[model samples]
Every structure is written in structure tokens, then in C-alpha cells.
Target: MSHGLSIGDLAARTGLAVSAIRFYETHDIIKPVRNAGGHRRYGRSDIRRLSFVMAAQKLGFSLSEIAPHLHRLPDHKAPTKADWTRISTKFRKDIDARIDALEELRDKLDGCIGCGCLSLKSCALYNPGDMKAAEGAGPRNLTAITT
Candidate 1:
């Protein structure tokens, strides 16, 4: 019996479906080894890796965004607490920026619905005769966070 977890064990530990584990594998988020029997075998670290992936996805991070951080982790063995702390520090900054953006959008959302109603003075605060059209499409004021 070679030392390593089966794909099923990985999924069970992470509460992810077998298919979902495979999808993560394809993205190189979790690199499993093949045992002598040619079956997939995962390291214990994979549980934490998949758990991190699940949490990041819940926070609206794309696989592309999450991949780089995970890729930096050692593939053959468990990562140290320092390794996780370093990655988490980076993520903390990103999370803070996202929180700021969401707060800005929340605070300003009521001012302009971008429904082409320029009558309200609040509309002037944001769109101002659709000047945002020249800047680019989409909710310009909401996205920019100018105030």
C-alpha cells in the first residue's frame, strides 16, 4: 500500500464531488500523484488546497486568479504555516479592495439607477447627461467610485 489518498478520499475530506476534484486537478490547483496501480493518489495537503479553492470561489475569485497562489505551494508535501500566511496576506489586500468597491457601489447605488432618468439631481452627481457614455459602456459612476 503506497502512501497517499485516493481521489475519493480527497473528495470526501474536502466535501467536494469527485468530478469537482478532477476539475481542480485540471487547473493544477491540486496535483495528485499516480500510484503503482495507476490510480490517482493525493497528498494530505490537497484537502487544504481544495478547501482554499472552495473558499476563494465563494468569495468570487476565478480559477485563473486562484491558480497562481496555489501553484506557488509545494506540490509534493504539506505547506508550512508561513507559506499559507504569505499567500493569505496577498489575498487580504485583494479582499479589502473588493470590500471597498462593494461599499462604494452600495453607498451610491440608490443615487443612480442609470435608467435614463436625468431629472433627479442625484443623476447629475453620477451620469451628468450621460457623459459616461464617452468614457465607456456599463455603469460608469458605480464602477469608478469617484466620490
Candidate 2:
């Protein structure tokens, strides 16, 4: 009934549930116009926006992190390949940091196990006597990683 795509059309095109599409709208990740009948009408650009969100989530990004980048792009304009490339480049540093943090955790866990600290009275990770409490709370070795 209009130039915009229907909610169902968008769901079918993106392989997303209608409710998920609505949810994205609520989060400002996808913007839809209301038709004369008050039904949600999305643009072709919305598909690309949602697809980017999907890819970003798969890469371990929270909606919060992806939202700012999406906000920078035009809502009604379809992003070019180069546009996506430029937006995605910023994530590399975050990905690298996560990888490094995970590696550090693995190494620390290995060290703890190799030292037979798992069931010992003097455990580094288990903190059997609150020994690492002096260094502060929660996963002493991985304290460098944050939200």
C-alpha cells in the first residue's frame, strides 16, 4: 500500500522474526515509518542496518557498542560496501583486546592447574584463604578486561 516495505516483507527479506524487527525498531537500530493504516513500513536501508547488527552481534559486540556506529550512518540511506568497511574497521581493536584477554585467562588457568592449586589449601584462583583478596575482587588474573 506504500513505497515502504511491510513489516512482514522485511522479516521475510532479512530472515528475522517480525517481533525481532519490532524490537530493533524500539532500540533505534531500525527505523520504520507508519503507513496510513498505522502499520510499520520499513525501507530497503533497514535491511542493511539489521544485517549489520546481526554481523556485529556474531562478533561478540553488545547492542550498545553497535548502536553508536549505526547512529552515525544515515537512517534512510543504504550503506555502501565502503561505508560498511569504514564502520567495521573500528571493531578490530576491540576484537584484538578480547582475544588477548581470553588468551591471558587460559594461560592463568593453566598455570593454576599446573601448580596443583585446584584442590590445594594454598590456591591462587580459589583463594582458599582469601589470599588474593589483597589484590581486589573477582578473577584476579583477568582484572584488566572490562565492559
Tell me the deviation in Å of residue 82 in model 1.
1.5
lDDT of each: 0.84, 0.77
Candidate 1 segments whose C-alpha is farther than 4 A from its true place: 113-121
Residues 74-105 of candidate 1 have per-residue lDDT tens digits of 98789999999999999998898889989888
- Model 2 off-target regions past 4 Å? 113-130, 145-147
Q: Each prediction's TM-score against the native?
A: 0.88, 0.77
The prediction achieving the highest TM-score against the true structure is: 1
Quick one: best lDDT, which candidate? 1
